[model samples]
Target: MALPTASLLAPGRVVPPAPLPAAEVARAAAPFGQSTMLPRGAYQDDQVLAWEREHLLDGWVCVGRSTEIAPKGMRAESIGRSGVLLVRDADGALRAFENACRHRGHELLPCGGSSQGTRAIVCPYHAWSYRHDGSMIGAPGFREVPGFDTSLYSLKPVRVEEWHGWVFVDTSGQAPDFGSHIGQLESVVERYDADALVTPVVHEYDVEANWKVIIENYQECYHCPSIHPELCRVSPPDSGDNIELEGNWIGGNMDLRTSAATMSLDGHTEGTVMARLDEVESRTVMYVAVMPNLLISLHPDYIMSHLLTPISPDRTRIRCSWAFPAEVVEREGFDPSYAVDFWDLTNRQDWAACEAVQRGMKTPSYEPGPLAPSEDGVYHFTQLMARAYQGQQA
Candidate 1:
């Protein structure tokens, strides 16, 4: 057989169906403050989605919680155009592999389910089985076939990592070390004891907007005073500041009001402060962005996470979860209703704003706008997107 071309193996290398004009491309490559949005087509075009799936989404994404796939558990998720399987082996180690059969390219495991004590992964089509480590275990009958080697046909593997009980997978298998990239985050968040926290509340929303709109809304609070009255009452809009990092992460801090102990509806904590936090730490809210898909907000009493998933050019899914100390949640009569209710209202407000922006972008008069001084985080995010879409690794 003839050798495959580089373009065949790396889809990102192929020319985009609808490429951005040269002038717009140059604008995107400029510094954060100097950069502006890509053309409106970049947000509503199918060709742009195809290019993004290959270059951006293939890098790394936070899929689910570690507890969801404990030892001997198996789950599947859609990454880009391919389905990926996440499995915890009998040894309690997590691994990710492509979810296709070696023989006929049929889907091996279903999208969501427990392995049910399955010893080996058997393909439903041809009964080809693979071990937990992705080694070929058995094939019914192939002894007479020429040049057939079971050793060469083991299942393909993807990169998976666990951080603070959250599971992340890299489809391209080229992502940098997770810890090395965001290790500085521990200095600011170690006091929160995130490892001891358990997520008990989750909110799912399907917004009619591009994924970038959601991320931009999150990185800046310039609209908080106008949109989120309750949020500004606690963490004032002007009280926030961000620090750009060298790795695939961004860090920032916002000071809560003097009388506020937490981010509840009334700016008070009904429970005790989080473990190990000093006086100042207890009154501040920290924001961290783990590039490509994860955003984390740490409070003195709890932690909140936003996972952005793109469904199409103009549709995105937002998964938000709130986690508190395991002991706090286990206590009887403990209600987090205040915090939940406060954020619930605030989230819907932001989602509405994003949807409105999406609708505006479809108009013929839409044009890229300049960034405000306080919207530094949005600028950084735009820079990252521009780099990735232009075939540069982020």
Candidate 2:
């Protein structure tokens, strides 16, 4: 929920912009040669934002690939969307909840609180705590109260399902099964063998662009040739075309010639695995922006996850994780330099480009440009934005 504007106002005075109320203008409108049914402002509207917060943001979305929390558990949150807590229980079953204490509305995990093998969630505000399963364990001074009911005070639990070692949570408490909602992505992701992978590095940055800008950037390769020189050199330029667009999702493949890159995580680079990329002509990398904010990259040898969290109307935080094979993890000395360096440089280039674009769009002279027939993926993405805001798919 948005904080109130009046809270910062002086008792009897006003600040700048008092002469004019904030105006709503959709930025960078583009015609797809299909229909002009939606406004660009829909991407930035407070009303539409509110609607999304109530509907989609409240609904389940992918959080992290299960590989991040497999042998040991980790913490996750949706931030403004909502706070979600996912932990592997004693029996090792994964559980997700609202990340809160039922009493006094305290956040269960602040500053990423850690749990011993036994200590579960506890409220920092009152010291009340719960079991790993989100069941209320103890709330001192409240149990003896005549009207207090522990049965109704368990921390709120969210719907969670692990698919392809990825953790997904729906906030509306009313989303279709995680696998079904993602369609064929389930099978496609499974082929990657994600569950066996181990994370080597987690890189995150905040970019000065709307969440949509980052999503659109990842959705197409039109800009790849110009913005990312090394990436374009590694992956064939102009090779990315929309292969699938389902509802709010977009996916495509980038063609790249692989190097000997000898050595799998297991140090068994001598086998067919090490030779697969070398033997192949133009290995391909797959990227999908699962609408809203979750963007995932499945490469020939490793996987990267980009999770976008909107900070404001024109800024977003991008969290990325580099994951690889587990055998290499057990080996314990593999440096992330091999895979991490490539993505870090590529993402930096993208951030620089997007920050400039955001500044350009702020000008009054800018207009929604026309989409060439070849740029259908960008067109489709904007179309979904319009549909999501104005058209109810159901």
Candidate 3:
């Protein structure tokens, strides 16, 4: 039977999805294999994102690599709606502050912008000047004001810390201590000597999907054989083991095919293996997701990172960078095209899948699904998120 043109041409309407229910939240936190996916509202609701911005991500979010800002350099970053300023002082110490000037709330540096060799942070609005350490230095037409103390007007401080060459900022002052937050990840990756490595390539992606969707994609290889043919050729889809750890993180490793050398397009590398890697470490790739916003992939010859910035309910911005040992990067005729191209292609594939999921979730018939045994990593992460929601409700 042929459908009428008028019926086909009519616009279809969809009712807005409801908020997450307590029952579903409990179901998502249930034991692995028994648990189902998080409720659709977790990904589709603006209110859920607002709660996450204030609780889950406001504290100890990874902003960028420490190497990006040189001595006397300053960069502006954002955590949800709040702005942050990262500074490398004259003494080479790293610091962070609220991006606003102490005088009139004007941003010292534009978001997503960087300044090098800066001597002072001067406000464009009122000419308030601050030193590299965030101490007030100059205040035009204010020194003589009654009881106006320069000491009391320094830029607001934000807790900053560095771990394995990555910079993290805590705006809420309520996150667990940095050490406890990092937990056993330090001992797990210490052999890589990540602090001594240098980043040589970075790529940004604006994905039309919830941040959690992208993370769920990274945690499991269930889709690798279908979407990432190149990756599957270099590493078996089933050759993975999830690690149990004590921290606000989740991770595991996958063994490389004996025929493969590294995770490049051709499964080979001209780069030298990291000096501290043992035999097993040299042949495996480790994937780690630090809570909130950082994803770290440790390879034998290089390290790759993905920093997530949630833009809206269905949008995220990702910063992906590749880091290699200094000696390997400085080698004559050294080229990183192999690694960069491989991941760039893989990343696009993942983004496409995440976008599809986002679109599907909006359909009226969409329902939460069960997790496969291979999806334990995803299950672990969802459990954490579900528990967080439960705690907030309580």
Candidate 4:
């Protein structure tokens, strides 16, 4: 059925979908963000899939959680729409795989790779085996088979790394190295030193909305003033001059209500957290939502790590973690929940917005609308998605 669009469109926004003469794909998308917004399902189109496979998947995908996996071959899954295995090697290095067995691709078949310890991954169906490094190690009666080259069936390895104790995995292998890509975000990361940290509380949610809607919710604070009363109390969204956003999110900054010079991972509300950021938790708060699925949020007393996973074009899963300085976590009377109220509340507001949009998009008027100049970050995301589909994969 032709979904309605008039209801979602702004006052005099998108008209009916009149087909346009073909032009360059980038130029075609120009109208979506510039003269008009994209039509409904732009987020769900097959062409968009083609673009993501080339640009996004080829880019870095975050797969980081340091303390979740134990020292002895621990395994954890970041179920962000996709099930990615976060595995720690026997030697402590973190590795991620597609969480499958070569024999009929079952996720449950394993003997040595179990809850306690993992010496090897044993498949139940055909007994195929793989090493921690993602190499295939065993295959039943392979020596007697004619075309049995076990070397060809290695477990596909995804690029993985740890930053401030957070483990990150990239399925696209095309993303710059974790260290290099993070270099662009050094100011916030260097301030937090999250790679060496540990999370005390983990939070996850399944919301009724598209993943893009959730991302747009995270990127801007324009709605903070009216919706998040507590957030406005502690850190007014209008006062977002605290942390400056670079690249696509330029001009915007952390809108902490205080005039503190900087914030750190530990949530300290004073000092030059951005300077000499090697070790001190001098500043009080910081936030960064990396492309695709990860958000790095820092507060004075703790840190909130978010992983945005898409269950489908319309549904999303948000994974959150609360990490603190190990000593503080070990201390008695340490309450991470005290710091969580602000984010938890803010997230609720965002969720409401996401649901509203999802419901509104079902109306026909939502197609090809206008852009609010203040929404540069969100608009940029749409543009990037469109541009990614413009060319053949480079």
Q: Which candidate is the best by lDDT?
A: 3
Q: Which ten residues in a row have the lowest lDDT in candidate 1?
A: 1-10
Off by over 4 Å in 2: 1-31, 34-48, 67-76, 111-118, 245-248, 258-282, 329-333
Q: How accurate is candidate 4 locally (lDDT)?
A: 0.57
- My TM-score estimates for the predictions, one after another, are 0.87, 0.81, 0.94, 0.76
Error of 4 at 325 (Å): 0.9
Look at candidate 2 and give me any clashing residue pairs: 26-40, 26-41, 29-368, 58-171, 58-172, 59-171, 60-169, 60-170, 66-165
Q: Write the per-residue lDDT of candidate 2 for residues 1-394, one digit (tens) a residue.
A: 1111111111222222211112211232224564332344444445555545555565556676665553335475754457887778766688888876786677776523445454566677998877777788878887688987677778787888886667777766655555446766654566667776777688879898877777777767778677776665556667754555223356777666344232122221211231223323125667877756688887666778898877675678887997766665556466666567777888898888878777777677764566555556665666555433432242
Order of models, best TM-score first: 3, 1, 2, 4
RMSD from true fold, candidate 4: 8.3
Ranking by lDDT: 3, 1, 2, 4
Model 2 is weakest, by summed lDDT over 10 consecutive residues, at 1-10
lDDT of 2 at 13: 24
Candidate 4 per-residue lDDT over residues 188-213, each given as its tens digit: 56655666565767777888887767
TM-score of 1: 0.87
- State each candidate's clash count: 0, 9, 0, 36
Q: State candidate 2's TM-score.
A: 0.81
lDDT-wise, the better of 1 and 2 is: 1
What lDDT would each prediction earn against the true structure? 0.76, 0.61, 0.86, 0.57
